[model samples]
Target: MRFPFFKQERRVEERPRDFRVISPRIIDILTHLKVQAEKLKRTYHRLLARDKELFEACVRAEQELDRDRATIYANEIAQLRKMSRTILKSQISLEKVIL
Candidate 1:
């Protein structure tokens, strides 16, 4: 004989899932993340441009045989490179989250 408990269980299992309730929030979050990644990329490019300018200055200082000025520019370039590396890591991490 058929059982009432089994009929109720089958009905519950057959109900369709509605993703419409959850998709918008996910889309918004991903869109925000993509924007952040783009911003980081722009910042990285700016840093690279600055680094190039500094390197040129440093080389000029060295050619002039000016020890003090060349040393200062070299130190500044090192700091800028370190900062650029950190920004790149952060951008990669955000992209991973978006994926």
Candidate 2:
């Protein structure tokens, strides 16, 4: 069924890709990745120092927590001792007389 309505077989032109330098966006992305890689490599070499700092920080935090815990325990013990002393003082003993 040929109606000859639409144009038959349009001719398309094939163009060759122009070889040019790298685009600025691509260059910037590559440079950024390169810098990031260098930073990662440097950090990898400093793992021991990083670990030591983390350990020292954890130790300091644990010591502070222990000091706070000790203070709380001491306060509770002092309160209990005061209550015991008060109870002992308030107790009355009846005198016993036997003939």
Best by TM-score: 1
Q: Residue 72 CA error for candidate 1 (Å)?
A: 1.0
Clashes of 1: 0
lDDT per residue (tens digit) for residues 10-61 in model 2 = 7989877664766898778767666655554455445435545545555565
True-structure lDDT of candidate 2? 0.52
Off by over 4 Å in 2: 1-20, 48-99
TM-score of 1: 0.77
lDDT of 1 by residue, 1-94 (tens): 7786775544545657775666878989989999999999999999999999999999999999998999999999999999999999999999
Largest lDDT belongs to which candidate?
1
Q: Distance from true position, residue 16, model 2, in Å?
A: 7.5
